[model samples]
Every structure is written in C-alpha cells, then in structure tokens.
Target: MRTRLFALAAVAATALSGMSACTDSDDGDGGAASGGGTRAGAGAGKVGVILPDTTTSQRWGTDDPKLLQAAFDAADVPVDIQNAQGDKAQFQRIADSMIAGGVKVLMIVNLDSATGKVVLDKAKAEGVRTIDYDRLTLNGGADYYVSFDNEQVGVLQGQGLVRCMGGGATAGAEPPMIADLNGSPTDNNASQFKEGYDSVLQPRYDSGEYLKGPDQSVEDWDNKEAGVVFREMWEQTNKNIDGVLAANDGLGNAAISILKKDGMNGKIPVTGQDATVQGLQNILAGDQCMTVYKPIKKEADAAADLAIRLYRGERPTTGDRVKDPESGAYVPAVLLDPLPIAKKDINLVIKDGFVEKKAVCAGRFAPLCRDAGIK
Candidate 1:
C-alpha cells in the first residue's frame, strides 16, 4: 500500500493552527446559533447556513457547524447554522425560516441543485446574499462558492489505486480489473469526482493497462446501500475485481466489508476520500489503500470569511472563479487544494488536528499507528 503520494502532504500548510473535536450543543430550536444579540445597523442580520446531512459524512454533523460558529463568533457576527438532515422539505423550510427572519446572508451545502435553486432564488428575491459551500448548486447561481479542488480529490483516488495495484499492467501479467464505487449521482461533486478519477483511469483502460469492471454510483452515499451495491458487483464479477476506486470513505468501507467477508480484503486495493477514522483504521489494518483529506477547517474558514464580509455589507473579492456547468455563469470562489493520504501519511492528518490521534489509534489500531510513526 506504499506509494510516493506522500509529496502531496504539503497541502497541510493551510491546516488549522489549533483546535480539537468537540460536541456542539443544540440551540434548543433544532439548530445551532452563535454570536451576540442583534446589532443595530444596515447589515447586522445574522448569517444563515444550511448543511446537507449528517449521515453521509461526519463533517456535516460534527465539524462544519462548530468551525463555522467559531468563525462567526470571533467576528461578533450572529449566525444560525442548521442541518437539513437529508430532507428536501426540511432544507426548504430551513431556508424559508432564515430568509423570513431577515438573515442578511444565507450559505448552504445544498442537498441538490433543484432544491438549492428554489431556496437561492427565494433568497435573491428577498435581497439576501447567498454562498454555495462545499457542494456547489448547479443552476442555483450562488453569489460565491467555497470548497477544495474536488476533482483533484478523485484524481488522487485513481492514482492511489494505480499505486496500490503495483503500477500499470505488467508485461507478462493480465491488466488489473478495477471497479468504481462512485458517490451519489445527484451530487455535483460526485460528477466532478467521477470526471477526475476517470481522467486518470480511462487512459489505462484504453491502453489495455487495466480492465474496467462494474461501475456504479451509490444512492445518496448511503453506507448500507453502498454495501449492497458492492456485494452485487462482487457477485457479478465473480470476485475477480482486483481494485476499487471508491469515491469516499463510506463507499470504500462498504467495498472493504464485502471483500473481508470473502477473505479478500487486503488482496484487493481500495481507495477512499474524506479520511474518516474508519477509513484511516482500514488503512492501518491493510484493508484499504488511501483516502483524500480535504481540510474542513480551511473550507469552513474560507466560507465563513466570505459570509462575514457579506454580513458586514462589504463586497468580497476572490481571485478564483468556478463556472456552473449547467448555468454557464461564473461564481466568485475560494478554492483550496486537497491532500491524498496513505498509511504512511496518516500522521500528517493527526498532526493537522483534523482527526485526533487518540480517536484514530484506539484499541487495536494503537500498535499499527506507532509502527507508522503516528506518534
């Protein structure tokens, strides 16, 4: 599972200076609100944020709101952050509540483009500034966008698979059979991720260096559904699948579980994103190859920076812009780079405080963590 991808560790330079994971208390009304009492002036209304869901990734439930709250609290700007819990109706209701409550700025990690566009359009009609956080709303036409180089995240997965498969097809051996366990089709980031990994893998498939196996997308990035999907692919492939390009940690773990059931876990290389504790443990145990780490603190900071500026009624300028592939409109953006993590690079993530060392090295993983110099 070793590779030269350790060079990508430089992206950690923008990591959080100091912060540990903590439990965020609820605001009693089914959301988390931070900052002081309402301030008097033109742009003093609280900033409203709507997160996508908590089940798909831990970041939505634990990391994002806390980081965003800290950012707003530091600037003394009131904010209301809420998770939609993966419901489109709840997403709309949350947006309606924020807008009707006179929020000056609304930021969101949209559940989907159609749902987001409705909310963004409503906010725009009400003179509230909007920002697309992490996942861009396709035709939503958000004023600004903040996220990492998501396509690059997929590129890393493809490259990681190649490295774990012992490089390209050998002269006397058959080309490795690769399976793609993609993210939800409805997510724009999912499409971008597939585009990225395909850029790296399609070439090999064409050159006879690799054989493409079952390619499928998990519905809503559900872990249980992902397990079912991977199991089906395993049966369809007659367990001949050699490697997996799983879009994120959840999907990757799903495939790894299926492989483990057949005692083929370590034999088949698997790639993941999000660098969750489970994913890191899998890397430690040799069940998975690598995961992409997109520093959430950096993303939350960048989005909050933009929201703070908007809340102050100050025009924000960003050097980067991302065009909405569906609308052909360019959005002001603050894009960060994503880092690829292998077993050897797990220490970098721990050192960055994204995942606590204790959480990653718990119980059975303690020895493996030490062997990898994670102390």
Candidate 2:
C-alpha cells in the first residue's frame, strides 16, 4: 500500500508540472478584460474561494490569501475567500452559502476529497463553475483544478533523504532505516507525494539496501497527531529509524519534535515540503533534509486567471484531463512544477522572491540565515 501510494503521488506531480509549464507562455494579464465571454462586461460576477484549514500550515494565512487576492485584484474580479477551519460540515455550509449568494466562480482547497465532491455537485447544480485549488476534487467533477507538481514534491523528499543518508553505501553496510509519515488518506496530493517518494525509496527497500520502519498515513495532516503517531512508532520500533519521509513540513516538524525529545534531533535525516518559514528554519538547523518549494504567487495568479475566465464564460487554455479515481472521468487540471530547496539553495527561494529575508531571518535564526547567504 505504501509503494502504491508513492507511485500515485509521482504521476500526479509530473502531470501537474507539465500542465503549469505549458500555460506559462500564454499572457494572461489585464484581469477579466483580456478574456472573451458574455459576463465580460466589467465585473459581472463574484468569485468564491474556500480554503481547507488555517491550523495545518502558514501558507493558509500568509501565502494563499495574498496571492489569490493579488491575482483577483489584477484581474479586476471581486472575490470572497473563506476558511472552513478543517470542519467538513462548515465547509459544506460555506459552499452552500456561496452558491445561494449567486457566486459565479467557486474555487476550493478541499479538506477531504469525498466531501469536496458534494460541494462541487452543489455548485454544478447551481450553475457555478468550480476550480479545485491545491487539493483536487476528483469525483467532484470540477470544471478545473490547479496545484503544484505534487509527485515531484515526493521525489524531492525521497531524493533528499537518500542524499542526506550519504548517497552511497557505507562499505557493505545495509541501507538506512526510514519511516513514512504521509498526509491525510483522503487528500489526493498526499497520495501523489507518496508516489514520488516511493518511486525513489521503494527500489532500495526492495533490494534490501534500505530498511523500512513503521509506515503510517497521518490523519488531516495534523501536526500534534503526527507527533503522537511518531512517538508511538518510535516506542514500538525501539528507535531503529534512521531517516523519515514526512510528506510535508508540518508532519516533518512534528516528527522532528518527537525525535528531539528522544535526543535524536540531528541524528536522523527527515524530508519536508512547502518551504515554510518553520520548515526552512529546520533545514537551516540541519534537522531536515530538504523541502519542495512551490511558489504560491504563480499558482494563485494562475488560479485567479482561470477563475476569471470561467466567470466570463471563456474557455480556458487547459488541454489535459486527469482521470478521477471515483468517477473514472477526465477532469481538467492545471499542474505546476515544484522546486527542491536544500541548505545550499536556501537563498534561491529568497532570490526568487518566494520568501522575504525578514520573515525567515528573525530571532536566533538571523545568524544562521546570514551564514546561509539568505540575503
């Protein structure tokens, strides 16, 4: 099951990357005026955005809203962005309210893929075009989906762990023992990430080059729950783990906290994603192997453009369709490439304007950030 999940993450990441790159050449500036459609006369309708949760990561509060807001403002479209706080019933109620409010475009980062389908169905019935943001609403049959190359996220995590383990075998020594702490079971991106990481790690495990430890899928990407789960795994396995393949930075941080309490901070190599401030701090401290950086600005801008197009009844330039697992139908999607950030390239994210120097270089991390050339 672990291997299968990893493979799926890889495929989804690759597909998303290809899609994101393909759309880069098209100039989508000037908001809704550039697109052709019936509702193109000024701002004809409102765009509704529903986010999954705020407690999971910093991106929800900082990056996601800012990027989406900038994009929508540039497109001259009115947007209403709401957070469900990880509540399924609340998410449903929010979507229902948006539909009743006569929203023309509905963009959502689904908390659960199954619940997302219900929201999408409701939107469709109400004649509202839906875009599955970040988390794909596969069975929901959304009009469009936008997100990073999720599988590549896994590949970077997997490759980083291998590199952190010293790249080559140590004189007839068996490969390092690693644990897999993945995201929620319902999140499609989690499966995609597992696929990418497993693509690189599974072969080693099968060949007896790397040892496998307790592999578990985290529920709802909860950091506290992840910490508890890792603690239990450590107790059960007697701390035999050498490396950890944590699906995202939140879980990685959770596992790292547990390892720290056990006096195993820098001893075990761990992988992460999102390139968040806390995650980057861990990387600088040499506690994390690496993180996959998906620029939120670009992703949010693209999603906003797509939403505006849909609102104006214009056909988007998306040419590919991803097959939904539940309905077995092709769903339109936009996939973006993800960058791998290591200690060496920590400055790159700063250079690319993904993160601000002040945001990452505060408090005790200032010296570390300066040493890392993070200006």
Candidate 3:
C-alpha cells in the first residue's frame, strides 16, 4: 500500500543539499533532520511540536513525537517536542518558550480553542509558521492542518455501533438507547467526529431506528470523568442505556470498565477510535466491538514534512484545505483516511507496522489472536 504520508512527495522541496532520508531505501527524500537545530548544519532551524494531554491517548506522548523526531533526525533539523498534559496554561508556556527559542515552525494539538488562539497568535507575531496538528485551532488560524478524515472516523464508529446493536429496518422494533461520550469540547476534531457520526445516527434517530440517550462531550477526554459521567447517565435511566457511541478508544475503555462492573462487557455494542492497546485488547478479548485505526506514523510524517518545508523557507503546497468553522478560512490540510479495526482487521495494523505482533499476541491474548488468524 502507498504510504498515506506520500501524498505530498512531489511538493517536497529539493533545496536541502545536506539533507538525508530517514531510511536508506526509497522512502522518499523528505526524511532527515540534524541532531538539533542548534547543531552546525545546512538546515539550522528547529521545529516546535506541542501535543495535548497524554491522558487522552498514549500515542500523543509515546508514539507520534518519536515518528516526527525520526523524520526530523533524517533531515538534519532539530525539534523541540513536548506534551501539554491537558493544561491550557502549560500549553501557552511551552509555546512561548519554543517561539522565544527561535523555532521556525510551530505545530500544536491544542488543549482548547481559547488558549490555542493565544499561543498561535504569539507564534505568528514572532514569525513562526504554525501548523495545526491533529486538532485545528478554530479561528486562531494556522499555516496548515494535518490529521485523519475525522468525520469518516465517526462514520466508522457509528456504523460499528449500529451493527453491534443488531440494527435493521424491521418495523416496530425499538432501537437501542446509546450514550455518546464524545471527546473534549475544546478540540475541533471532536466536533468533526460528532458531525460524521451524527450524519449516520441522526438519520436513524429521525426514523426511530435509534434512540438518543445521554450525550455530552467530556471535558478533556478524561477517562475517569467519562466513567463517572456515563455511570450516572446509565443508572439514572435505570440501566436502560443499551450501548455506547464513545468517541475514541480511551472513552470506549472507560465505558468498558463500567460495563465490566455491571457484567455488560461485550453484551452491548460500543464504538471507539484511535485503536489504542487497551481498545485492541478489549476487541481481542470480546469486551469491545471495534476501534478506528488512524496511523500515527502517517500523520506525524506528514506534519514533519510540512514543518521541514516551513523551516527551510519553502512555501509548502496542498490542494486540499479544511474549512475553519470560526474564521471561515480554508486552511490547507492533508486529511488521511482512518481504518476501522474489528476482530477481523487486526492483521492489517500489525502488517503495516502500526502495532506490534508481540503486543497483540502476548499471554492471555495468544489464544484469541490465534483464533483470529493473527499467527
């Protein structure tokens, strides 16, 4: 399969005579960076990467930054990658330091729209080109935006939930009462995800094929809070809530934990995204229905490519742009397709290097993995 990050290969600038690719093979010319932007090299400017809290997903801290750093390592450019840890104030402080340290490019997965605007504005005033990574900054504006086709992510999640609920057009059947534990209200991707799933669910709801239950966005994709909130919603309705429309793997796991307590794990349909280790394990063990897999390597690579171009004083080009709802600006974007992973589709991620065969097939999961033809 063609790597999704290869979409902008042609637009990769060839001006770096001293650059190197991340791999020795034909992985394309846009891979290398210096030991540090401070090191004596041809591309001497650092790129700033500010990821939102690690509580929401492990990828932001453990996986994504490493991928981006590897690509930067190949390009001989330096990067300052840091995590905001869900604190808006910390996010601003980190951005301020990056800008003051003379980073040429700034990429962020914002904690919320309010503080994001402040950081992005500061970066712009300092002549730092900004790229909205994973989450858009709304009206804050940026040089580019890169992420998965989040709406499609919701479509997959919604469809998965419906299937798990035994959805059909049979007349007079009452649809399941589903709880929507969406992501943080501060993030734009959360809203886009809702838009995607709502496209599928609202129609079903309108036709009386699905019943809307308690629907609320988590404050910061807080799993602990998700558990508390969902439990209250479900218990308040006398445990009549039939299933869940969880926004991501974290929330799904949160709800699954609650379901396990009530002996409802895998008994009712639940949907998720991000395909985290916990989410996949839940799927293999028959505790969760599915999780959408958005390859972090592809996303980080694309963001790194854009950042490299910006740091090199090259005008990066992208034909596709995502509309900023608040500003009405069509910010250039490279939105990749997300894969829906069920019990059957586990091998695709393993084969594509998105997950470890060892991680998926270890110990208790061995039999389940073998049963799924993972071996």
Candidate 4:
C-alpha cells in the first residue's frame, strides 16, 4: 500500500512541477474547532483539508487524511489536514487558520451548512478556492464537490439486504418486517444514503414484498442514540423486525450488538456503508449482510487531483454535475461509483489494497479471515 501510494505521489509531483504560479489568489481568509490540528508540509503550494469529525466515522481522521495526504505528497503539493471532532465552531476556526496561512485550495467535509457557509464565504473573500470534499456545502459557493455516488451506496445496501433476507428466508413466508436506522438529517450525504436505500426498499414495501417496521433517523449518526432507539423500537415492535436497514457501519454495528443480545445477530439481515474494518469483520461473522465500499484510495486520489487542479487555477473537467439539494444549484461534481461488499467480494477490497490483510486478520479474527479465504 505504501509503495503504490508513493508511486502515485511521485507522478503527481512531475505533473504539478512549475505550476505553482498559475493561480495568483493563493491566500485566503477563512475561519473552526478544537481540531485534530494541521499537518504542515513544505512544497510549492499548500492545500488545506478539513475533515468533519473523528468521532462520527474513522474515515475522517484515519483513512481519508492518509490517502489524501499521500496523493498531495506524490504530486509535491503541500497539504494541511485537520479534523473538527464534530465541533462546528472548531471547524470554522481550523479553516480560519488554514486561510490565514495562505492555503491555495481548501477542501472540507462540512459539519453543517450553517457553519460551512460562513467558512466558505470567508475563504472566497480571501481569494482561496474551495472544494467540497466527501460532503457538499449547499450554497456555500464551493468551487467543486467530490464524493461517492452516495445514492448508489444506498442502492447497494438495499440490494444487499434484499439478497440476504430473500435468499435465506423460506419462500412463501410472511412478509418480512424491516426497520430503518438512518443517518443524521443534517448531512447531505446522509440524505443521499437515505434516498438511495429508500428508493430500493420503498418499492418493495409498497408492493407488500416487505413490510415497513420501526424507522428512525440517528442524529449526528450517533451509535449510542441508535442503540437506544433500536432497543426501544425492538421492544415496541415485540422484537418483530426481520431485517435491518442501517445507514452506515456504526449504526449497523449498534443494531448488531443489540440483536446479538437477543440471539438474532446472523438471523436478520443488516446493511451498512463505509466498509470500515468492523463492517468487513461483521460481514465475515455473518452479522452484517454487506457494506458499501467507496475505495478510499481512489476517492482520496481524486480529491487530491482535483484540489491540485483547483489550486493551479485550472478548470477541472467533470463527467457530471449534481444539484445541491439545499440551494438547487448544479455544481461541478466528480461522483465515483460505490461498490457492494459482501463476504464473497471481501477479496475485492483486499485485492484493491483498501485493507491490509493483517488489519482484518489480526487477533481472534485471524481464523475467521482464514476461513473466509482471506489469508
């Protein structure tokens, strides 16, 4: 993984050579959080990256920054990556510091639009170009947006759930009652996830192929809150849920924990996204049906490439454009397709080098991974 990433960076450095002065407006005034802080790099120009929260998803603090930084480093572009840890105010402050430091490109995963708008507005005033990374900042006037085809992520989840539940269940059995544990309403990606999964599930529900059970939105994608809600919903439904449509890996794991207590872990199908280590492990253990794998390296590489172009004052070509749900303005976008990861396809991520063999094979999971032909 390290070797391949460095090779990518080396190539990028060649391409970006002597391109620093292409953009005159490199300095920006922007405003954020008690951040994970910044990682300063010495290069021709700097790209400032702000990840939303380490608490919500490990991708923000772990996977994304590593890949994003590697991409920037390969191209010899200096980068500063930081996290807000879910604090909107801290996110603003981090942006301010980046802007004051004369960052050429500002890429962010917004905590919320209200706070994001202020930061974007500030960056714009300082002549800094902005890229909405992972999450869109509706009407924030970001120059470009990059992320997975989030709705397709949901479609994959819904499809995976249908496979797990439909394949295992006895034909002609009573319509299965399913529950939804969605992500926070505040996130644009969360809404896209809901829409994606809902698009697949709602039709089944309407046709009586599946029955809708308890459905709830998890504020901030909080697992503890999801656990509480799932527990109560389970009790209220008399433990009637036959399938679970969890929005992401965290919520899926939360539901899995509760279901395990009731001895229903592998018996009910649960769907998730982010394809975190836990999510992959759960798929191996049969507790989770599948997870949406966005291939962080590709995502990070794309964002970094886009950031480099944006910093060089180049119009990055986009295959498509998407309307920000909030502002209804079509923004240039680079939306990558999401892949569905079930146990059989776990090898895909492994082969793609998304997860190191040792990371998933460590400890007691070694035997399970070996049993799954992962070793």
Candidate 5:
C-alpha cells in the first residue's frame, strides 16, 4: 500500500506540472477549506475532499468543512476541500480535476451511491487512496470509511420519540397516530436510520400501541419539498398525527412549520437528528421532542488521521468493519457513538462546542436557554 501510494504521487506530480492550477473562484467550487486553488504544484500531492452540498444539513456547508480543515491543518497536511453544491455532473468534474491535479488521497461525502461509485472507482483506478467521509457508497469500495454509528442515530431518534410520546407499552383508549418523514431515499444513512427506527417502532405498530400513519421519503432532503410532502400527509390523515419521526433537523423543522400553521406545534411530538441549531432551538421552544447529536469534530478528526497517514503512504487500521448490503463486502470503519438531546440535554450540545451558545441562545431563545440551565 505504501509503495503504490508513492508511485501514484510521483505520477500525479508529473501530470500536474503541465496543468494550470485552479482556485476556489472556479465555478461550482464551494471554495477550498484549507487553502486556495488545487493548481498549486506544492499541494498537488495533498489530500482532496469533496463535500455533498450546503443545503440538506447545515453541517455539510458549515460544520464538517470547518472541522475537517482544522484537523488537517493541525497535522500540517496540505489539503484542498470543496463542496459539489448538490450537482452530480459538478461532482464528477471536481473529482476528475482533483485526480488530474495529482492528489494521492481522495475523500468524499457522496451525493448518492451511484455517483459515488463512479468517483471512487476512478480514484482507485489511478491508485489514489479513497476514504468515504460520512455517507457510504454502496459498492463503491473505498479503502476506508469514517463516520458516526448511523443506525444508532436512528435508534436514538425512535427511542426519543417514544419517550416524548409519554413512553410505556400500554396505549390509552386510542393509540397515538405516528408519521415518519424520512431523509433522501438515495442516502444510505437515511436507509440505516429508517432501519433502526423501524426496529423500535414496528413492534409498537404490531401490538396496537401506536398507529402507523403517513410515511414518505424526501427526494434530496430538500426542506421546501419536505414541507410540501408533510402538508399532504397532514391533510391525508385529517390532521390527526400525534407524533412525527423526522429523519433530521431540517425535516423536523419543516413539520413544525406546518404544525404551527394549525396551532399544533407543541401538541404533536416530533423527533430529529444532527443536533443542528434550529433543532436545538425547537427542543427548547417545546416544538420538537428530541435530536441526536453526532459530534462531527470527532468524526472529522478520525477521518483526517486516516487521510494523513494514507497521504504519507501509511496504511491505517480500524477495529470496526461495516458490511455493505449491496456488495456483500466489509469496509474498514471508524464509527463514533451519538448522543440523544432532549430539552434538558440542549445545554450539553452547547457545552460540547458542537454549536455556539450565541447561535442557539440568540433572539427569543435567550430565556429558554437560560431556563434550560445553559451557562
């Protein structure tokens, strides 16, 4: 592995000599997180990263890039990172550009498995070591994977919703009507989340303890589209939804928006993930039931350590292996645990620096933050 990495780097360095380096100013560039321009001959041997988009979750645009960049910088590694901004064609273009520019290591948070397979396959063909940052590429076959235990994230979501709905196996005269607004159907993490949550919720549905209501997936985890889909669900059920199992904070907030229109925000318990600022505030406001917080800094540091070692032609080892359902292959993985955050746990997110106190405590959330014992 070490010998092949150096050979690939030598070839890339030779190839990059003739190419004009490009900067973050280039079209479709989310801009470099560590340094400007992939064209820098000095950085041609550096690791390259491609983020999915700035939309679906705030972490993609703001949190992950910042944290990942800091990790690489602290290790004194020259890295170039950019976001695809949700365009498949653009994602390919960026990957091709990075490969041609001579990056020995390539990392990505895939837009989807199909597109991700293409990128990972190309990188592997060029002998460039590949790492799946967060979302796994079904059969893409990257060299390594680093992320939180996603199914556990879903388990927390399901468990949190049950707790918010007043807990216990026994239902009242009428079982609460439950609905689920899942994430993008293309994202494997979404499937894993559904798998975990279903594991917990299915039993309740079978025993007549909870009524399964409208369940649908947002195409791209689009927030506006999420609101539209949820509104139809609300109408289809005649506004009888007693709880919402939203896959993430964005979708959870969308459900809350529709619920607010009907003056039912706090009346219906809703579940979320990502521990986003909006989701945390919603919990404080009594609009959302709970959120799952996967510390992205820890994930980024783990990934960075792997990438740095690979960039230096060192093969790193991981104790965990995740099986790819499609390809039947096991991937070396570094999986982190996730925390469930209710109203009382909101301060934990703040204290951990996952989110800033000013951001969550701003405006109308000030009093709520203080009441929650947030210092």
Candidate 6:
C-alpha cells in the first residue's frame, strides 16, 4: 500500500513538473500577454499544494488537481502538488519539504485541523503565504480561506433529509428516526456543517417532529469506521432508522452499504456532500437522497488566484471574515454557496461537466443512467 501511494505521488510530481516547465515562458498572472509585452512575473517562484487524502473521495484524485492545475497553468505559476494520503506525519513532512524548497505560496487541505494549525504557524514564521483550501485550518494563521458556504451545506443536508421523510406538514406524526454521522472532528468544516444541519434538524427534533438516534463523528472521515459505527447504531436502534444525515458522500456511501446488508436499501433516505460519482450513482439507485454540489473549478480557481495575489504582496478581496479560534484574529475569506443535487438535477451536474456521464453510468448503473436521462 505504501509503495503504491508513493508511486502515485511520484507520478503526480512528475506530471506537475512537466506542465510547469512547459508553461515557464509565460507570465504567472494567468493573463494573456500583448504581442510584444513581457508576461507578468515570468518565471515566478513555485506554488506548493498539499492535499489531504485520496482514499476518502474520488474528487481529490480527479477534479481537484485538474481544476487547480488549469488555474495555475493559466496563471503561469509552477506547481508542486502532493497528497498526504490521510497521514498526519506525511502531511507535516510534505509541508516541510515545500517550505524548504523555497515555495513562495502554500495551499493545503489539512487532514487534521490541530496539526494543520502548527504547520500553518511554521509557514507564517517563514514568510510563506498560506491559503486554507476547502477545509479551514482553525487557530492557524491563514492569509486567506477559500471554500463554500459550509453552514448552508449542512442546512441542505438537514432539509434534504426532512424532505425524504415525506410531507413536511405531517412529519410530526410520522417522526422518522434518523442517525447523524458527522465528518472528522478535527475539521472546522465538520462543525460548520453540523451547525447548518443541526439548525434545521434541531427544530424538527425539538418539536417532536423527528427522532434522532445516536449521532457519531467519524475520525478522519473514514468510511470503514463510519460503517462500523452505523452498523452498531442500526443494531442499537433495533433497525428502526428511517433516515441518515451523513456528513459527506464517502460516509453516506458507507452507511448505505451497511443499510443494504441489513436489507434496508431504498427504504431510508441518506444525505451527503461533495457530489462524488458514487454518491450520484447512489442517488439514482434510490439508495442515497441528495448531495451538496460544490464546484471544484470555482473553488480551485479562487484559491490559485488568491495565492498568486498574496505572493505578489497584494491582499485578495473576500466578502466574509472568520475569526481564528486560537489566535482571536479575523481573516479574509471567500465563501461560495453550495447547491443540493437530487436525482432530478443529476443532469445539471453533468451539464456542468463536473462528472462525465460515462464515469457515472458505467457498470451496473448503466441502465439507471439511461433511465435518468444522463446521456
């Protein structure tokens, strides 16, 4: 497993280096140059990207890197991308290496928020600008944070589950029982998602319109752990679970798998985030209810642009300010909105080219794909 992971990293590094060298002659601003005008910041310093993990979702391997690389290439900035594969020690080592290699800007999707805070502190001390990508690194001094409106993401999850419970007006009488499986405890986004979801669900729960079972926070957002946790919840609840509020697609899928084993497939509604291929398939298959669609291209582009601006000693524009939990300092942040996707809007995700139809429709899902008009 270690060898395969390292090999994948090597391939990614080589690919990035090749692309960087090819685009080195252009200016780093990502703007087209006039006929005889010199490119802006031509041969600018390197930009290092430290991604969290690939095991959790397919987006890390496909959408994230592709979009980020395109944005960086257009900006003409060289990039060095690495995946930590959910290893905190490996994440630290990767950050250290990037800093030592004289990277001017560093972007990271931290696997562990506490450890990430330490890494960000080191980057700040070394004068390297840091952009917290997707997941915020709490208590860490981050120059900029780029992500979706996380609270809204949770609200969507809550609302979707409520909808899945059937008529909102009669939800009180039915009072579907649900299990809440949140993401990694260390990630600040997890809390933000919980806030949004709870804000919606708590009202229903308090009004006796819905019954919530055991709510568990999965460590590292591990699907296997989520499966085990959910299985235990199933047994504890005597298999009376009617709905599930899973933090993301990976965990939702894990929960769904366990539900299927218990012969509860398509009977309960499950919520998810990050409109991953599997999540979308599950939606079409009637196993999962909905997923929050956060366009990776928009996010990756924004982060790259902000990182470049910071590298040039410019403050990027951001609409929101988030206080650092540890430092008590407010930082500029760009918070985008999230879209909830169901089987009906699967075409929208496809129209946006977030996922290829073939990728989602392959294997057993092919027939379902055609039925859903995925072509």
Best by TM-score: 1
Query: How accurate locally, in lDDT, is each candidate?
Result: 0.83, 0.79, 0.79, 0.78, 0.83, 0.78
User: What TM-score, over all chains together, does every model reach?
Assistant: 0.89, 0.88, 0.88, 0.87, 0.88, 0.86
The C-alpha local distance difference test score for the whole of candidate 1 amounts to: 0.83
Cα RMSD for candidates in order: 8.2, 6.3, 6.5, 7.0, 9.6, 9.7
* Model 2 ranges with Cα > 4 A deviation: 1-43, 168-174
| Candidate 3 structure quality by residue, lDDT tens digits, 21-101 | 332123332212212233212255588899987778889878987798999999888899999888888999999988788
Model 2 per-residue lDDT tens digits across residues 1-375: 111111212333243333322232246321122122233322456999999889888889778898888888887788999999999999999999987887888899999988898898877766676788988776677777777778778888888889888853466786678899999998998998998999999899887878888899999999999999999988888888889899889999999999999789888998888899889999988888798898777778768877876665555545344667777755665666788889889898888777887878888889998788777
Candidate 4 off by > 4 Å: 1-45, 167-173
Q: Whole-model lDDT for model 5 versus the true structure?
A: 0.83
What is the C-alpha lDDT profile of model 5 across 1-375, one tens digit per residue? 001112111121232222222332344211122222332223348799999999889999999899889989998998999999999999999999998888878999999999999998887777677899988899888878777778888889999999899953353567788999999999999999999899999999998889899999999899999999999999999999999999999999999999999999999999999999999999999999999999787788778877776676455555566888889877776677788999988888888898999999999999999998999
TM-score attained by model 2: 0.88
**Residue 48 miss distance in model 6 (angstroms):** 0.9
Tens-place lDDT digits, model 6, residues 1-375: 000111111122221222211142434422111221222232446889999888888888778888888888887778898999888999999999987777777899999778798787777666676788988787776777777778889999999988987843363365678799999888888998999999998888887778878899999889999999999999999898888999999999999999889788888999999999999999999999999998777778677876666555444345455666667766666666689999988999988889989889989999998898876
Worst 10 residues of 2 by lDDT: 1-10
What lDDT score goes with residue 353 in model 3? 82
Q: Name the runs in model 6 displaced over 4 angstroms.
A: 1-44, 168-174
Off by over 4 Å in 5: 1-44, 168-172
Least lDDT summed over 10 consecutive residues: which range in candidate 4?
1-10
For model 6 the local lDDT of residue 280 reads 97
Q: What is the lDDT of residue 293 in candidate 2?
A: 90
